[model samples]
Each structure stands twice: as structure tokens, then as C-alpha cells.
Target chain A: MAERCAIVGIGQTHHTARRDDVSIAGLLREAALRALDDAGLDWPDVDAVVIGKAPDMFEGVMMPELYLADALGAVGKPMLRVHTAGSVGGSTAIVAASLIQAGIHERVLTVAFEKQSESNAMWALTVKTPLQAAVVAGAGGYFAPLVRGYMQRSGAPEDTGIRVAVKDRANALKNPYAHIRDPNLTFDAIAGSPMLWDPIRFHETCPSSDGACAMVLTSERAIPRPKLAPAWVHSMAMRSEPTQFAGQEKINPVSGQMCAKEVYSKAGITDPRREIDAAEIYVPFSWFEPMWMENLGFAEVGQGWKMTYEGATALDGDLPVNCSGGVLSSNPIGASGMLRFAEAAMQVRGQAGEHQVDGAKIALGHAYGGGSQFFSMWIVGSARP
Target chain B: MADEAKPVTNIKTPMRLEYRYSAGVATSRFLRGIGQGKILGQRCPSCRKVYVPPRGSCPRCAVPTVEEVELSDEGTITTFAIVRVPSENIDVPLPFASVHVLLDGCDIPFFSVVQECPVDQIRIGMRVQAVWVPKEELTSTLQSIRYFKPTGEPDVPFEKLKEFL
Candidate 1:
């Protein structure tokens, strides 16, 4: 078996539309420095660094790791760059954990970020290429039809998306770092929002954000002698499949299910909805909260929306999901995945102050990317295996 | 898994984007040379492989390719595909050929449009030369080279062009 690892520190920037105060490196360093301070360690304590981000085209910076070496304290150390589209942040964290798990590094620093103000992500994601199918609209346009398919298949109520939007926006008020903090958000406001993509209102979509998230993982033996509780890494897994093929199901992708199964099995979780005390899932679009609920096996097919409607995934529910407001509130493309991973760790460690679920012992983090083909998930617990 | 559903064959959509690439040092120099009627390649000192449309670093060697090499405008078509279907970005008429031009002294071939020949006449190892825009109208972009035209020379041996392809 691989060596055990625990998350010793976590940090994230205050997500928003623009972070004009810092350069790209400065933005990363802000989160990294915070993580280092939280861990009570210095740059020399980190054995290596792992960084991930979405397409470089999103920020007009190609292979930015080369320029971010010094800021990440990898001047003469091993540094790995990961790019798995939107799931890159979570994948990067997994790679960092693997370093400690494999007995390679005692402490590894991982960070992910996106500066959306530098370029228009909607345009970047929907750009036309020669000899390819056209995606005239942005992400909402691309995913609206899929959302419609899910609604049709599940026979869910038309207001499910609006309910999710209101719930998450209300939750964001408790999260100071969240990009969108609408304390007065209500179902009516969401339902009355403009329809950017049919079936996806303005309030139902995630905001474009500029932010970063960082974490410090340590081998079991290297855990700090005196510190707040650390979140033990129970299991992590990633899965992928072709983006599109004949008869492929995009709504509940097989890759996402397979990935969840592996992670749950590894963590010895028999019933995710009951056993997982909390979940920080990637839910950029409001409908995705339920769609992913079904895909991740938390609810039976065509019944996941009931969990949302019944408030089972809310802050006071039996299984709290996205207690930190999730991607729907702060989506910094690259960092969104890592934010889920970090927020899960926070819940397990009892570090999620206002949004914490009472006595959250185990939590799950999930992220998906690239037409829902790439999946990354991790299960963390307050106790050791 | 649920029973498979019917396959989707076609869906039409449109996507248009505007981007400003910083075109770092290597690329800026390469584009400048193109505007001046010269094809340029950068040599990876470690691997000795030359790259056209010079990049920040060599993919194979994982090292910066700095030494600039002047490449001949004339080259051989290492491989090509005939376009039978038209799309929004493809301005060339149907049956036009897109070729991988292996410029002389460069190990890697660059993709470009091949014209002045019938689609049926296009073949691997075909000799061709760049058709540049008028010198007075030159700009720091690949558009400086309108297309590649046949040079009427004997085809390069298939064996020699195989590795380049």
C-alpha cells in the first residue's frame, strides 16, 4: 500500500471577476503564501510543486508554469504541470497527494488559478476552428440542450434550476471568499432573471471569476506535531472517455460514474448519500447539482432532483453539498476543481467556519471537464484509515 | 448501461472568437522573417531538429530552440489531404489540397494550402514553392505566403519523404 497523506494547509483567493491588484504570478503567490503560513512552514519546507489550470488560451498565457517557477518556490525543484481542461485543479491536487503517497515527497504544494479578466472565457471556449462542428454559443448554449435532456429523462419540475440557484446564492453569503454573495437572493429573483440559454437563466449560471486555490499536503510521518486537525486522504481517482461518439450518454456520463465508484470503493463507502457527511461538487450550472447527484450515485436515476428539493444537499441537511457555495458562486475555471477539493478538506477538518456542517466527519470532492468526459474525485475524512 | 439510443449525425452551430496572441520572441522573429520573404526555422541544439513557425521550446528535447536557420521557400509535399467538403473557414474551393510542406533543411513539415494543381495531381513527395504576396504588401503574418505552387521538378523519393511525413 502507498504511504498515507493528509492535507495540512489550504488557502484560496477572494474570487471575483478581476484581481487587478496582482499579476498572474502574484495571484498564485497570494494563495501559496497563505497556504504556507497556514501550515506554519516556509518555501524550503516544500519538496516540490504541482500546478494545474485550464487551457492557456483562457488567459492568453501558454505553459505559465515556466514563468511562475520562482513564485511557486520551484526554482531548482521538480515541478509538474497538469492540464485536463476544467478538472485540472482537482487532478493537480491528486498528483500532489500521489507524491506523498508514493513516499517521494513529504510535503508538496499544489495550486490552480484563472484570471478571467485577461480574456473573455466565453469566446475562448467557443472559438471556431477549421473543419470542426460549430459551437456558436458559449458554455450555456452548449450545455442547455443537455440540461433539457436530463429534465426530460427525469421528469423533474421546471423550477428545479431556480431552486438550486437560490439555495447556492444564499449559501454564498456565508462564504466571504465566494465571488457572488447575494444575501437577498430568492427563487423569484432567479426565476425572473434573463434567459441567457433557454432552461438556464442568468442566475443559474456560474459567474466568471479570477481566483486561485492552494493546498499543502504532507506524508503521515511528516504531519505537524502540534496543529489543528488535518484531513486524512482516504482515496482519490480519475476517469475519462471520448467526448462524443455514437450513442454516448452525455447527461450521466459513464466516466463520472466509474470515477465515483472507484473513489467510494476505495474509501469503503457503501452508501454515498448516507456515509458522505458532505460533498463539494463542481456545479457550475444550477441544474448540474442534481445531474451530478445522479451521476455520482448519490440518488437513483431520475430522482436526484428530489434530494435538492427536499434540502438534503443544503447546509442543515443530512448530507451537505457545496457548503462553501461551490462553483455556482465562484468559478475561476482552473481553480474551481481545486476549490472543491479544498472545501471538502475544510469540512472534514472542521475548518469551514460559518458553512460547516455540524460534526462533518467525512466529505467528498468532485470535478468534471471536457464535455463531461474527464472526472476527478477524492474522499477525505477526519479520522485515519 | 441503458439501451443505446439512436446516433446523432449532424448539428449545425457557429462560433467566432477574437484573440491577441503575444507571439513571444521566437514567434515574433519568425513572423518578421516571413513578412520579409524568408522562411525561418529554429534548431534545437540538443536534438538537432529544426522547427518551423518557431515555438518557445522544442517538444521532443524539452529545451529552447534558439539558433535561427533560413529555410528555402521551395519544399516537397510530405503528405496532403484533398478537401471534398466545404466549411465556414475553408475559403478554398472544393477539391483543393492541404499539404504538409517539408521545407529544405528542416526536419519537420509545416501545414499550408497547395494550389496551381488539380486535386488528382497532388501526391506525396511533390515539389512545391511558396507563393508570397507582393513584397510591398507584406505583413508580419503567415498570410504573407498566399499558398504553395508546383515547382515542376521530379518528385522527391518516397523513401526520403517518409520520415518527414
Candidate 2:
């Protein structure tokens, strides 16, 4: 278990489909330097670095950390690469926290990113295993079927997915660092857009992006001096199971349920829906908002769709989710999970300007990956855990 | 319409990406087992759990699976996906089914494909058996089973194969 860790710094690139202006190393440094600046620290203050991503094939680069050591200022420092599929970003952050919690390092810099401009995401996902039939065409392709399943099971109104896309995009307009900021976005355009997979539409899908998210985590003693106001890390948790099994509930996976329960217990929260003021959840597709609402115990099973319909998950709702647009607006696969974790910290630190939840006391940072089997969540509070 | 109906030489810039990974010790052992025409699984001493497509340790117990077992190539299809996309290490016709096959004598199911049949006929609980590659072509992989085919027997009862879930 980690002793105790706090997030002192957070930074992320302006997400977009193409970042032709910089190399993969340059992109990572852009986010890292800004985070160090935010924390009021220099390179030497960082003792180690942890990097993460969805897969190496996404950029056609293998073990990329070895090539990016110098750019990230991690050549002389220990660097670890984490890949728990999409949850890798959150796991990388947790690994950094563990180092601080374990009394091994006072300060650890964690960064996760993906340069999707270099290769087609569709092609990367289709990389074959011998004799194994391929069903996934791309991120959108693999998830489309799941979205259809969600709609079928929940009987959620067709307007619900459209509403989620519109709401998150509207929120993105307030986040300067968000990848896609089209103020012209509206519900009708989303509803009228081509349906890529039955219930999911093109406008409703997350954009393939090139961006990075970074954070500087420190031990208890490392805080209280020389940095911008820091958000104390209250607690963190991760859990996983096989990708699929018969009788496995993919929509609201049991592993996600256990992970949430473990995290809340460690954080000492009796009622998350009331105790936590806000949240930033992973929602690459619009349907996940309701699915996660139930999985996180914010609402009952099969009633997650009710939260969205009742305006409980909206921006001005009781608990605003993904105020920074989330994966729904700017999805840089590797960095997306961290962005949720970082955005949650931004809320507690009061750094979130327009999208702030207004004096958030405690918040939930959630991320899941690999057919919804891997879950990494944290409960962060303004007050110490 | 002319271009759409054009010949094979009329195409353009195609998308191609490949990954080359080091088959670390665990993968090496798995493939070597295939090369020898044997199905080997790693067993966790502490939990006594067996993992096919063997890994270094039990994911749950986080302890090493140092023991080995040779499993049978016959099992039932648990669930599957039909492939319509072409990719590396596989060259099959469109609309082929990829099924999770629980090999006989193994505790868990590993991924494999079924051939010598139509896609619509592939069903869960279908009895399928492995068809091995020629010995010289074998490597450390589940690919040692060239493809699974219907055993042409009465389908296995759901109650007998319920543990796969």
C-alpha cells in the first residue's frame, strides 16, 4: 500500500487528431515541462519517471520509453512503462504514487501519451494473433457493438447518447486545453449525424487525438512549501479480471464494482453519491456515463440511464461528470485515463476555472480498460484522507 | 463507376502496420510446447490454478506457476467472433469464426479459429478439435493448432461445460 501521496502539478497538451508540430518525445516534454512549472519545480527535483500508453503499435514504436528517456529527463532516473490497456494512464499515476507512498521517492513525474497521427488506430487494433479471428476494426468498431448492447439492455432513449455528446462538448468549450472545442456543436447536429453503429453516431464518438497528460506526485513532506497549491492524494485503487468469461457482465463489470468498493473503503467514504462532490469518469462512448453511474454505485443497476435522463449527470446536475470534456471530446488513448485523474485533482485544487464544480470537497477519478475488465479509481479530497 | 469496376492494379496507398515483440521466457515455453506437439499449461503451486497460454504466474495469487501439465486438444467453443478483416500471422477467408475453446484437460479456454465450415453454422457449445500444423512448421504458439474443426459429434451439453463461464 502507498503511504500517502499528493498531486502537486498537472498539465496536458491541446488534444487534436494530429500533432504534426512535434515528435512523440517533444509532445511528452511539452506536458511534462508545464507540469513542473505548475509545481514550481525543476528537472533535478524529479527522482523518477513513469510512462504509459495503450499499446506500442499505436505509434509503430516499441518500448518507446527507451528512446524518450533523454527528452523526458529520465535517462539517469528510473523509468517504468505501464500498459493495462487504456487504464494504463491511471495505473502509471498509481505506480508513481506507490513510490512516494512506499518511502522510496519523494517526487515522481508520471506522463502518458499517444500520437495517433502517425498511424491509423483502426489498423493498430486489428493486429492479429495466429488463428484468432479478428472482430475489432478500431476503437469505434469494437465499442459500437457494446454501445448497441447498452442501448438494448438499458432501453435508454436515443436522445440520451446525443445529449451526453452535446453536454460534454459544450463543457469542452470552457477548457482551453481540451482537444475539440467547437462552440457551434449542438444536439441536433449530433442527432442528425451519421450513425456509425446503430445507436452511436459519428458526432457522438470520441475523437482520435494526439495529446499527453502529466502529473508531479510527491510524498507528505514534499508538500507545504515552494509549489502552487497542491491537491492531496487521499487514496487510490486498481482491480482487473480476464477480458471475457461466460456469464460475465461486460456492461457493468463485477471487477469495476469491486474496484469502486475497495477504493471507497480505503478512502473511508460511507456514501459516495453524497460524500463525493463531483467526478471525472472515462467515457469514450456516450453510453458509458450511465453504465459507470451504476457501476460506481452512484446509482442502482439498470437505473444509471435514469441519472442521465433526470439531469443528475449533467453539468449543473448533482454530480457533474467529465467537466473537462473527458474521453468523449479529446481521447488521446494513453493520456485519456490520466486526464480523468488529473482533471479530478484540478477540481480539488480549485485550478479548474470555468468548468469548476464550485468548491468541490471530494471527487472521484475513474478509468477502465480492456473490455471493461480493468478498473483504476481514486477518491481525492481537499482535506487529507 | 469505371474506377470502382477497375482491375486489381488500379488501387493506391494501403494501410500497413506490424509489431515485432520479444517472446519472453513464458511465450518461449508456450511455443516450444506447441512445436513438440504437446499442450503445456503452467500451474500455480500456492493456489493450484492452471493457466493455459501459460504466463509466469497466477494473476490472482501473484505466485509462480512452476508446475506443468499436458492438455488435450479437444474442447467446446465457449463464445466467438467472426473475422472479416485481414491481419498478420493469419490468412483466412472473410467471415471466419474465432472461438474461445476449452481444450480438454485444461482449466481455462484459449483463443482459436474454426475452419472447414460455414460461418452461420458456428455455434456456442459446439464440439471442435484441433488440427495441428506439420511438425517442422510448429513454433511456440497456440498457432500450433492450425485451426479447430467440428468433431461431427452430438453437441456437448451446457451442464457439462458450465465451468468455462
- List per-candidate RMSD values in Å: 15.9, 7.6
Q: Using alpha carbons, what is the TM-score of model 1?
A: 0.71
The estimated TM-scores of all candidates read 0.71, 0.75
State which docking tier applies to candidate 1: incorrect
- Candidate 2 to native Cα RMSD, angstroms: 7.6
TM-score values for chain B across all models: 0.86, 0.78
In model 1, pairs of residues that clash are A136-B14
* Candidate 1 residue-wise lDDT, B5-112, digit = tens: 955533333445566647788988998898789988898888787788787567656678799999999999866655443433445656566666778888776767
Itemize residue pairs with steric clashes in candidate 2: A3-A101, B31-B140, B31-B141, B32-B140
lDDT of 2 by residue, B1-165 (tens): 366665553223344656666666765687788889987888767767667777677766666667888888888886555655444435656656666677876766776678998977876678999899898887666656778999987887755654454
* Candidate 1: true interface contacts recovered: 0.00
Candidate 1 lDDT, A1-385, residue by residue in tens: 8999999999999999988778888889989988888888889999999999998887776799999998899998999999998899999999999999999999999999998888778757866642222422556655665676677668899999988888888889889999999876788888988766556788899999999999999999888742577899999999988653323567899899999999999999999989999999999999999999999999998899999999998999877889899999999999999999999999999999899888999999999899888999999999996
- Candidate with maximal lDDT: 1
- What TM-score does candidate 2 get on C-alpha atoms? 0.75
What Cα-based lDDT does every candidate model obtain? 0.85, 0.80
Worst 10 residues of 2 chain B by lDDT: B6-15
Q: CA lDDT of A336 in candidate 1?
A: 97
